[model samples]
Target: MAGNWNNLQVPAGVRDLLPAEAAALRELEQELVAFFQSWGYQEVLTPTFEFVETFQAGSPAGDEGSLYKFIDREGRVLALRPEMTAPIARLVATSLRREALPLRLCYSARVFRYEEPQAGRLREFHQAGVELIGAGGVAADGEIIALAVETLLKAGLKDFRLGIGQVAVTKGVLQDLDLPREAVARIKVALAGKDLVGLERLVDEYSLTGLKRRQLELLATLHGGKEALEEARANFIQTGAAAALAGLEEVWQALTAYGLEKWLFIDLGILRDFDYYTGIVFEGYVPGLGVPVCGGGRYDGLVGQFGYPCPATGFALGLERVLMARGEGQGGGQGGYLVAGRDLAAVLRRARELRRPGVMVIIDGESQNRQEAAARAAARGLALVWVD
Candidate 1:
C-alpha cells in the first residue's frame, strides 16, 4: 500500500483555524451574542446540517448548487448549512409555533458554501445574525438596520458605511418591463453585481423599450443619499416595482424618524444573492475592502414557505470580514494557551482556571523543560502560560 502523506493536508479553500484565530473568532461571536441580547434578541442554535430539501426551497442567491452534500445512514440527502436564515424560519414555523409575536432571535454559527475562498471569503465561515419575526411595516425594517449599525459599532468598526437598498425598487422596475420571471431573475443578478454589460444584454434579450432600458441603466448608479431615491422615482414607472420602491421610501422615513439616517445610504441597485429576501436590503462596507462586512434584509415570506406566515427582517455580520476590515487578519494573539507541567493535576486545574472560553492546550510531559514547552506552544501558534 502506498503511503498517504501526500494528501494529508486539508482540502483547498478549507483550513483548520489555529488556536489564536479560533479564540479571536469566539470572542467576536460572544460580543455579537451579547450585543443582540442587549437588544432583547434571544440567542438560538440550529443544527450544523439539514435535509437538502430545506435549502432547496426558494434560495434567492440563485442555483449555486449545494456546497456540501452527504448520504446519511437513512440514505437521506443532507447538506451542510449554507446560511442560517432558512433554518431560523423553519424553527419559527415548527419548533416555536406558539411563540409570541415580534420574536427576536440571534445566532452565531459556521455556514458552509462551496466557492472560491479568498481574504474575507471562506468555504466555512462564521456568521452572527439576528432575526425579528412577526413584525411588519417600515418601523421593523428601520429597527433591523439600526440594530445592524449598532452591532458593527460595538465591534469597534468606525470607518464603514451601510449601503441601503430596497429590493422592492428593483422588483418595481422589473414589473414595468413585462419581462418573464426568468428574465427578471437574471436581470436582478446582473444588477446586483453592478454588471452593466450583463444587464444591458438582458435588456436587449427582453426587447425592453428605451425608457425601461434607461431605467435599468440608471438603477446601477442609483446609490447615494435621498436624491438617489428621487432620481429612481422620476425614471421608473409606478408598477409593482414602484410599489416596492414605495415601501423603501417608508423604510427610509422610519430610519429618519429614528435619527439613524446618517448611518444609511440609499442604493436602489442593491440586491443580496439570497432568493428569500423580499423587501429592504442593506450591506456594510469599509473603504478599502471589495466586499461588504455584513449584509441582510427583510425576508417576510420565508416563514410562509415553511408552513407559516410571519413578517421578518434580519442581518448577518461576517466576523472574519469585520476583523479584516478592522486591520486584524489571521495571525495574532487570538488562539490557545500552553499549560505544561509534570504534575498533571495542577497543570490541568490551572489551565481550566485561566481558560477564558477560547481555545486552550494543556501539555502533560515530564521530560520537557519550561523553555522547551514554551517554544513548542509558540511554534504551534499558541501563547505560553506556564503553570507548574
Candidate 2:
C-alpha cells in the first residue's frame, strides 16, 4: 500500500539542498579548494566511514556517543566519520608516512554525527579544511591561523574574529591548582563556555582563594589583543603555563607579521577540545552566529594514535555556516546559458560549443518557441540564447 508515503521523509538533523543551494555549495567548495591549493596544500579524500577506533583516537571524551555506528558482516564495528581531521590522520599515518616530513593536505567532504540539530548544528554537514602534518612549533601554528583568517575573508565574510589560544596554558594553570581531575574537568567547562557565574561557584566550592581563585577566573576573562597575553604571562610566569604562553606569543607575532592580526584576538579559554588539541587552538566567530564558523589547532600527538607519531595543525570551515554568514543565495545564475531553438542539431552544436569549465549550458527540450524558451531561461536565472 502507498499508505504513509508522505511520512517517508529524511530523518532529523539532516536536510537536502535545492538546486541553487547545491550550486552555491559547490562554488564555495571550489573556491576553498583552489585557495587551499594556492597555499601548497594538496587535496585528499577519505572514506565516508571508518573503523570506530579511528574517530575515537582523536575525539574528546564522552563524544563517542555521538557516532552513528553499525557492525559489518565481519563483526567489526564501523561508524560514519564525525570529522575530517581524524580520518585524515589515519590516512597520513598509513599511506603518506614515507612521503615527507611536512605534508599539507586538504579535503571537502561530508561528516556525520548524531546530535540534536539546531541553528548552525546538523547531523550531516560538509567541511572544507587543511591539515599540516609533521610540522611543530610556532611557524606551523601561525600558518594555520593565518590561513584561517584568509579563508574567512576569501569566503566573503568581512565581519568575523579568530580567537587564538593555547590549551596547554589552560591545562598548566589548572594543574597548578592541584584540583582533582573531575573538578578540573568541571572548571574547564565553565571557562570554555565563558560562564563567569558558574566559574565563581566552582571557585567557591573548591575553596580556591587568593591567587588560585583569581588565576582560575583569569582564564575566563583573559581575552583581547596583546594585552591578554601580557596579563596571562604576569599571572602564570612561574608555572608550566610559561612555556605554552611563550609558544602562543610566537604564533601571535608571526600572524602580526602576516598583517592578519587585525582579524585575530587572544582567548586563552578557547580550548576547542581539551583532550584532542595539544597547543595553539582557535575558533572563528561571526557577530550573529551562535556557534563557531571554523576552528582548528595543533595536535602534536593525534597522528601518534594511529601508530605513526607526528605533529599536525589544521582547521575546518563549516560550509553551511560560512554560506549563512555570507548571506547569499548564490543561485545557479552565474555563467549559466540556456541555448534554445527549434533546430535540434543547431541547439546541440551550440550547447557543446558553449560548455566549458566554469560555464553551464543547457539546451532547450520542452520550449516550442523563443518566447517559451526565454521564459524558461528567465525562470532558471540563465542567460537566454535564441537560435532561429
Candidate 3:
C-alpha cells in the first residue's frame, strides 16, 4: 500500500456512478432528450469550461465567487461553468446568429460549481434544459413552462409544485428603494438564499424605513396563488412593476389554457441568478427533497452581451435531484452472454440475429463446451444457451 504512490481517488464533492445508476441516468436523459426534441427543441453542446471573463458580465451576487477557477497554460483564467444560461446565451450570440430568429435549443451538459456536498447539492451535476432565443412573449415562456411540466410527468413523478415569480416585481421594489449598489447586492444575497432575517437586517442597515421596509418584509411572504400577484401588483405599480406583472398574468393565462394551472403558483419573492434573469422565474419542487429539482426563467438581454442582441428564456433540470426523487428501482434487465462452443461464427450470427431494440446479446469471449457455456450463460441471467 505504501509503495503505490499514484492515488486513484476522485476529488471530494464528486462521485463515480456505478453501472446501474449510470444506466438509469442515461435512460432518464434519453427520455428528456426525446421529450425536448418532440417540442421542436434542437440539441446543442458547449464547452465544459470557458474563459473567466465570460461570467463576469453584470455578474450575479455570488456567481463569480462560486466558480471553480484556475489559470490556463496561456495565463488566462478559465472556469468550469457554474450555470448554463449565460453560456447558452453566448452561444446564440456568437455561433448561431445567422441560423434564424426565435431559436429553440436544448442541451444535456455537466456543469461545475464549488459548493459544499450535501443531499441534493453536488460540485458536479448534469443539467438538461432548453433555451428559447429571439422570443419575447408570454407564449414562449408558457411553452417552456408547459414543456417542463410534461417532461416531469413523463419522468414518472406524481407530486410536485411549480412556483413561478416575476423578478421584475422584486427589481421594482429595489428600484423604488433606490438603495446604494452595495445595499442592493446585500439584499440580493439574502433573497437568493431565502434568508428572511438577513433581509430584515439589511433593510435596517441601509436605513430603509417606511414603505421600503414594509415592502421588503412583505416580499418574503409574497408566495402562493393569485393573492400574491394581486398584492405584488398593488404594492409595485408605483414602482414600475407593471410590465413584469402583466407578463406574469399573460403567462398564467396561457398556462391555464394548457390546463397546467393546478401545478403552478406565484411567488414574487422568487429571484434567481440575478445577472441575467430579466422577467419570469420559476422553480419545480417535489416532496422528500430540500432543493428544487428544476429551475430557470427568462433572460431578455443575456445574448446581447455577447455582441448580438436577442431576448431569451429557458430552464435547466438537475438530473441528480430528479433521480433522487425517482429513486433506484430495478436494474436494467437485458439478455446476457451467448457462448460459442465449436462454431464461433454461427454463434456470432445467431447473436446478431437475436439482438433487437432495447435488448442485448453478447457473444462469449472464448470457445467453451456446451455445458460450461450454458452454465456461464445461466449465471448472467440469459435463459437460452445457443452454442453451436
Q: Which candidate is the best by lDDT?
A: 2
TM-score of structure candidate 2: 0.95
lDDT of 2 by residue, 360-382 (tens): 89988889998999999998788
lDDT of 1 by residue, 1-388 (tens): 3688757778766777776577677788898999899999999999999997778753545574745889999999898998899899999999998988999999999999887777777888889999999998878888899899889999889888898887776777777878777878788879877788888788788888777888788878777777887787777755446666777888788777878777788877888868788888999989888878999999888899899998999999988888788776663664677788778788878877876754556564642778888788877777777665
**Full-model lDDT for every candidate:** 0.82, 0.88, 0.82
Q: How would you order the candidates by TM-score, starting with the best?
A: 2, 3, 1
Per-candidate Cα RMSD to the true structure, in Å, reads 3.8, 1.8, 2.8
Clashing pairs in 2: none
- Ten-residue segment with the worst summed lDDT in candidate 1? 58-67
**CA error at residue 321 for candidate 3, angstroms:** 1.2
TM-score of each: 0.84, 0.95, 0.89
lDDT over C-alpha atoms for residue 270 of model 3: 76
**Backbone clashes per model, in order?**
11, 0, 0
